[model samples]
Target: MKLQIDRIINEEKIEIDEVIDFSNVSMPVKIVEPVKIHLNFENLGKREVRVSGEILATLRLTCVVCLEEFDEKLKIEVDETYIPETFIENRKEERPIEELSEFTYKGSYLDTFEIVRDNILEFIPPYPKCPKCASKTEEI
Candidate 1:
């Protein structure tokens, strides 16, 4: 989902609520269901935008303990800031370490799909377990 930078700047804030299809994209893990995202894009001056919202999705994962397939529901809260790509070039020398950690966008649009994909990947469990195995472990 690409959003126009100009519109966000003019309106100061934009709210998005939709289900996005990622079947065509190559994802590291299997996303069994469409991703539901409710996001707020707020222009924070100087071409910087703050993206805050929630993402919900179901992922098909393999349980490490039982070696069975299971669906894991994810509800991730997002709070990120994006700066213009050119800002790096302009303030390379003066930019602080923390500022360098923010995401950057180029040209006239902000590609939110990438951001959503990255966050999903980051939130995946390192060791996934099926409900049966999870409950068994808890009982131990």
Candidate 2:
């Protein structure tokens, strides 16, 4: 979802509860339901914003060994600081090792959908196993 950061730029802090559309979420596995995202944004200063939230969804994942599809809960905590591109340009020259790892936003909006998608994908294991399959493998 696209969050309007400009709205909270003047405010001290803001809390938002939104339901994201996972029906069109592109994933390696299948998302059986929509995602719920609860976010708190605070303006660190004029040029910086902090976004912290939780992404919750249920997914249909296939077990690698058994090859059976099963439902699983996907929950990921997101805590990121976003700054302008100019901030990176200024800091990049100071310390090359430190690097600019924080998220960057352009204009008045921040596209949070990509962040949510990436975190969810990273949370998934390369090899997924159901409870039954995991128990069977443990006995071996």
Candidate 3:
């Protein structure tokens, strides 16, 4: 989702709670439901912002052992700081090492869809197992 920096700068903070559609996007796994996001964005001054939130979604995954399709619920927590693109150029030489790890926004907006998508992808289990198989393995 794309958020306007101007709004956060003007209001100092904003809260968002909505469902994001990703039907058109390409993903490694099937997303069976809309992504639900609940976030708070706070301006940290000097073109820096803090984003904190939770993302919820259901994904369709195939069990590695049984080869059956099953739904998996994902809950991802987000806590990130964002710096303006101009901040990098202005302080390229003086930028601290820690600052390099922070996320950057271009121009007047922050598009977090990619970040969210990546988080979702990372949350997937590499070797997924259906509930039945998972329980059986646990007893072994």
Instruction: Please provide TM-scores, in order, for all candidate models, with all chains considered together.
Output: 0.90, 0.82, 0.84
lDDT of 1 by residue, 1-140 (tens): 79999999999999999888888879878999899999999999998999999999899899999899999999999998898888877874776777644888889898778878989999999999999999999999
Please give the range of 10 consecutive residues that has the lowest summed lDDT in model 1: 92-101
Arrange candidates by lDDT, descending.
1, 3, 2
Tens digits of per-residue lDDT, candidate 2, 8-72, equal: 68775778787777787567878887778887888888668887989898888889999999888
For residue 104, model 1's alpha carbon misses the true position, in angstroms, by 0.7
RMSD of each: 1.8, 2.5, 2.5
Residue 101, model 2, lDDT? 41
Q: Which stretches of candidate 1 lie over 4 Å from their true place?
A: 93-101
Clash pairs, candidate 3, are none
Between the candidate structures 2 and 3, which one is better when assessed by TM-score? Answer: 3
Model 1, residue 128: distance off in Å is 0.7
Strongest candidate by lDDT: 1
Question: Candidate 2, overall lDDT?
Answer: 0.78
What local lDDT does model 2 show for residue 44? 82
Clashes of each: 0, 0, 0
